[model samples]
Target: MPVISYELPDRFVAGAVGQPGERAFYLQARSGRRVTSVALEKFQVTLLAERLEELLDEVRRRGGDDAPVPAATPSELLDDEPLDQPVEEEFRVGTMALAWDPEGEQVVIEAQEATEGESAEPEVGDDDPAIAVLRVRITAAQARAFAERALKVVAAGRPPCPLCGNPLDTAGHVCPRQNGYLG
Candidate 1:
């Protein structure tokens, strides 16, 4: 089975290769010794950042700054490692789950592969060929940094179509809003 490490990540960020729709996004987390990378769609990265911000707001509203998260700027927290080499994916993530751990004051991110359908029984232990889950624990400060950097990476891609909200290409895009005509 493939190994999924459970530890506090010192560096965590969502990065992509290519442009917009053609982009291949990856969720990467690195500790002192280990680096874990998982392939996911660009939309997944966007949604994760959005949901994490909402969770953080809710926590702050309910708890009233009890933990007092340290101030961390995005530049100070970015992962410096090149995503090109020595970063083989553990799995292609199919489902994602995120939660805030109140007791630990940490954000927990989990990504899992698509499982068998309801009609199929799940395999166990040696019967299962690969580990399908990746989980990482990160601080709230790190969460903010991650969110900021993720948005920058996403926005650096192609501009969006004003009418349909889909990314527009340099050559142009056929927007559905305009009845499938290039706008």
Candidate 2:
């Protein structure tokens, strides 16, 4: 009946209110058009669930001569929908990249091993091995936070390149990379 959608800031499903010593109603969102019903504490969950259930029942009863049956059961009230994809967490160290995938809903952590101190050869000898990959699943909330943090980091701007800490300006500088130093 009542559908609850939670994104960034808030996370909650719609439910019904109850009188003193009475059971309240709750609706957990399943899909775009369906919500399952459950009982909850009054004044805590929203009343929308009860309202939608009443409306749906009324419509069903009007269409059919027999009593309208509920389409779902209380056990199915909780959401079983597939969760959103996780966001990638990347750290840039010099030219190397370390990354991991994290699930926001649960506490999970993964790390990428350092690739330094290795020979230039790509071949893996008996002792040396390739680096392992890290994968994580993060909730929508986690994704949003990650994006926000990246934006802030970019806004702060990066330290001058170690090769040239000073401004290049239009004159440019004399470096092996360049033809000549115009300064």
Candidate 3:
């Protein structure tokens, strides 16, 4: 299956169309006029942002950021609305990874489709093009912006319980740690 690769996206963001925990999480990359949306777990979005930040930090430590890549400001290329209405999940993500391409001088994020249930096979092979893989490339500056935006977006969800660390809806939640006690 051919991978949907976006090399140096002009606009990239991780966004949710609906309320947190009740909505889908997507990683969108747009180059020129081509736009691709890929489905992923909310935690994946959080981890992706964190890892991207780490990658950029490593580059800076190694003097790679000194290149003429031109630092990109998050606000300048940010897309609050990454996708069109009636958002759909391209595929349920199974495994994902991130790496810095020294030659390419970009952070590459790759996500593979997760197969249903458990598998006994020694190896996994996907022949479905529609659910093959999604890859996005972005710069160190863009990564920093993404990390900042993603942290904010994830935090904007339901506030967490101070004691139990569980997300509390507007109606609150019956935290098991409270043992039937609202307080």
Pick the TM-score winner.
1
Alpha-carbon local distance difference test for all models: 0.74, 0.30, 0.71
Candidate 3: clashing residue pairs, number: 0
> Quick one: ranking by lDDT, best first?
1, 3, 2
TM-score of each prediction: 0.82, 0.22, 0.80
Candidate 3: Cα lDDT at 96:
73
lDDT, candidate 3, at 162: 91
Q: Regarding lDDT, does 1 or 2 come out ahead?
A: 1
Candidate 1 lDDT over 72-128, as tens digits, reads 445667654446446677778766778888888988887776565523333212133
Off by over 4 Å in 3: 64-75, 117-131
Error of 2 at 27 (Å): 38
Model 2 lDDT per residue over 1-183, tens place = 111222222212322233322423332223443332333333222122333344444544664644333433334233332222221112211111112222222211122233566444332111223453222223323323333332332223323333655334344555444435554
User: Model 1 lDDT vs. the true structure?
Assistant: 0.74
TM-score of 3: 0.80
